[model samples]
Target: MDQERARLLASVLAPGVSEYVVLLMEGDPASKARPRFGGGRTYKTAADTAAETATGWALRRSFRQPWTGNVGLGCVFFRPNRQRIDTDNLVKHVCDAGNGIAWVDDAQITAEFGVVELDVEHPRTLIVVTRHVSSLDRSDLVGTMPRPRRTR
Candidate 1:
C-alpha cells in the first residue's frame, strides 16, 4: 500500500471508535468455508484457525468496538504463497472473522473494497480492515424512475 493512501485511511479510521488491523498470516492464507448439503461444512480446520486468529488479534488490540451504524471496509490480501484463491472467498473469511470482534456483524459493513496480489518476498496474507462510509450516489435509483415526456 502507498504511504499516502495509508495516511488517508488513518485519517478516517479513528482509534477507539473505528480502526484498521493488518493481519500477517504466514504461508498461504485460507479462504472462506462452504457448507455442504449433508449438514456439514468443508475446511473445518481452516475455519477454526481463522476464527481463532482473528478473534485473538482483536482481543489483543481491543478491537471489540461494535459499531451500530453502517461500516465502510477495505481489505488487501498479499497472498504470495497461494497459487489460486478468489478474492470473494478471502473476503468472506476476513469478514466472518471480524464479526463481533471488529464490528457488530459483517452485514453492517455496507461499503467494501478488496484487493489481492502476490508478494513473493513476504509470502503472507495481509488484511487491511478499515471503517468506511457508503456512497450516497443514487444514479441507479434515478435510472429506475420513469422520465416525463414533453407532449408539446
Candidate 2:
C-alpha cells in the first residue's frame, strides 16, 4: 500500500470503532454483471467471478468474523478510466463478494453508500463495513412534525 492509502486505513481503523472492518483492494473495480443464461442454467461471467473471488480474499484478510447484526456498507470505487458504470452495480458486486465472509448475508446491510471516481494511477476499491446504529427515535420526532387532525 502507498503512503496515502496506509494513512486512510489507519484513520478508519482508529480506536473507538467497536465493530467495523476496512478493506482496501488494489485492482480494477468491477461492477456486478448480469447473469448469463445457457444450458437451462444461469451463471456469472468469468470476469465477474474472478473479481468476486479477488474481493472475497481481500475481505477475508481484513475481517476476522462475519458480522451478525445489521451493518452499514460504504464503498468508494476508483476507476482507471472514465467509463460509464452504475454505482449501484458496483456496490452490489462488493456486497455479494462479502457474503459469508464480512457479514452473515448481504440482506444484513440496512444502510449503504457508494461512489465512483476516476484515478488512472491507482485504480482500486475501498469498502468499509460498520455496525448500524439507528440515529432516530420517537423522542426525536416530538414537536418536529405536526400531528394529523382527526376526521369527523
Candidate 3:
C-alpha cells in the first residue's frame, strides 16, 4: 500500500468498531456491464466477469468475514483518462463483487456514495465499508428537519 492509501485506511478506522473494512484496488476501475442474452441464457460479458473476479479477490484479502448487519458503502474511482462513465455503474460492480466477502448481499448496504475522477498516473478504486449509522442516531440532526404536525 502506498502512503496516501495507508493514511486513508487509517483515517476511517475507529478504535472500537470492528466492522469497518477498506479495500484499495490498483487498476483502471471497471463499470458494471449489462448482462447479455443468447442461446437461451443470460450471462455476463467476459470482461465484466474478469473484472468482478479480480475485485472479489482484492476484497476477500481485506475482509475475512461478511458483515451481517446494515452496511454503508462508499467508493472513489480514479479513472485513467477523462472518459465519461456512469458513477452508478462503477458502484454497482464494486458492490456486486463484494458479495459473500465484504457482506452477505448487496442489499445489506443501506447507504451508498460514490465519486469518479481522473487520475492519469495511478488509476484505482478505493472502497470503504462500515456499519450503517442512521441520521436518527446522531445528535446533530437538530434543525435539519421539522417535526410533523399532529392532526386530530
Candidate 4:
C-alpha cells in the first residue's frame, strides 16, 4: 500500500486504550483469531496510552504471484470475548467515520472505493498495529494442508 493510503487508514483506527496483536498464520485458511492479553484495565488515549512497537515480527509464509499486500487495517473494542477480537466493529466504525473513503466487507478492502474516503468532520488519530507472520517456525506450509493431486 502507498504511504497516503497507509496514513489515511492509520488515522481512522481511533485505537482505544486496549492494544491489539495481528496474528499471521501460514498455510492456514483466511481466518482471524482474537487477541490474547492478560485481563486488566482498558487503556484509553488520555491515560498512559503510549505507542509501542510490536515484537516477534516476521513473515511466516510466502504467497504466489498476484498476491495483494498483507497489511490490512482493522480494529477492536472492549468486548466479552477479547480473545476473539471483533473485526465487525472496526469495519462499522471506519465506514461510519470515513463517510465512504474506504470500502470494507467480509471479502475485501478498497481504499478510496467508498463514498467518503476520509473523516475530516470527526477527525480521528489512529494507532498503527503491525502484524508479524507466525508461520516461520512451523512446517514449510504452516497454515496449509496438502491435498491429493486431481486428474483432469
Candidate 5:
C-alpha cells in the first residue's frame, strides 16, 4: 500500500469510514496494474486459506510494508451504498488522507478487484479482488447469513 495514498484516503473518507488499498487490472493486462479500492478475500497469511465468511464489503491484507522491497498490507472499504460509477467516466478527485489520493476515472482503471497477490518487482495479476463493482450485495436485503429451521 502507498503510505501517501493511505493518508489521503483517511482524510477524505468519513471519520471511522472503512478504507483499503487494492491492486486492480484492466482485462488481466500485464505491466499496467494500478491500485484499486478495498475488497478481497481474507487470508491468514499470504498463502493461507480464504475466510469462510466475507467481512464487511471489503477484505484487507494482514500488514503493510515499510521501506522494503516487497510489502503486502492491502485495505478494504465496505460501503454498500457508495454509488458504483462507470470507470470510463470516473473523475479525478482527491482526498485528504495524504496527497496521493486522486480522482481515478474508469478509462484509467483497467479492471477492478481486491488484490490476491502483489508482485511489485514484476508486472503481474497478483493484485486483484474477488468482488467486482458489478457484484451486488444481498446482506441487508436479506438477513445476516440465512438461518436454518429445526426439524423433527
Candidate 6:
C-alpha cells in the first residue's frame, strides 16, 4: 500500500479500533494433502499435528480477548525457509485457532486482510485483532459523533 492511501485509511478508521497481536511459530503450514481412505476418513500429518500444537500454545500465551462484536483481522505470515508454499492455504488454520480467544468466532470477523513475507531471521505469523469500526458500542458511537442531533 502507498503512504498516502494508508494515511487516508488510517485517518478514517484508526481511532475506533484497539488491537492485539499473537506471535506464531513460522513455516508450519497445515498439511492439506489427504491420502485415499476406505471410508473417506482423513488424518493429520506430522506437520499438521505440530501446527495445531503451536496454534494452541500461541493462543494460550496471548491474552484471552473475547470480543463478541465484529473484528478486523490482519495476519502476516513469515516463512523461515523458502520451500514454495501457497499463501492462501495458511488463512484457515490460523483463523480457526484464533476462534474463541481472539474473537467470539471467526465468523464475527468482518474485515480481514494480510500479507505473506519471508522472515528468514525470525520467522513468525503475526495475527492482529482489532475491534471493527462498525462494531463499536452505542455509547461509544454517541461520543464519537461530530455533533448532537437536534430534534424535539
- Give the higher-lDDT candidate: 3 or 5: 3
Model 2 lDDT per residue over 11-113, tens place: 4433244555667778789899999999999999999999899888888777666666566787888999998999999999999998877776787776787
RMSD in order of candidates = 13.3, 12.7, 11.9, 17.1, 17.1, 11.2
Model 1, global lDDT: 0.57
Instruction: Give the runs in model 5 whose Cα sits over 4 Å from its true position.
Output: 16-142, 146-152
lDDT of each: 0.57, 0.74, 0.76, 0.27, 0.25, 0.56
Worst 10 residues of 5 by lDDT: 91-100
Candidate 4 residues 1-152, lDDT tens each? Answer: 22354444444442222322232222211112223445575433321111110111121112111112122344322222223324453334333322111211212222111112233333222323322132222222223332322434
Ranking by TM-score: 3, 2, 6, 1, 5, 4
**Per-model TM-score versus the true fold:** 0.61, 0.76, 0.76, 0.18, 0.21, 0.62
For model 6, how does the per-residue alpha-carbon lDDT over 1-152 read when each residue is reduced to its tens digit? 22343333333333455354435455544533333455678666676666756775677566444456656666667777787766656766766666555555667666666567776877666566566666533232222223322334
Q: How big is the RMSD of model 2?
A: 12.7
Question: Which ranges of candidate 3 are over 4 A from the true structure?
Answer: 1-19, 135-152
Error of 4 at 90 (Å): 4.3
lDDT of 3 by residue, 26-106 (tens): 889999999999999999999999999999989877775666666778788999998889999999999999887777778
lDDT of 4: 0.27
User: In lDDT terms, which candidate is top?
Assistant: 3
Clashing pairs in 1: 72-132
**Candidate 3 lDDT (Cα, whole model)?**
0.76
TM-score: the better of candidates 3 and 5? 3
Any runs in candidate 6 off by more than 4 Å, and if so which?
A: 1-15, 22-38, 135-152
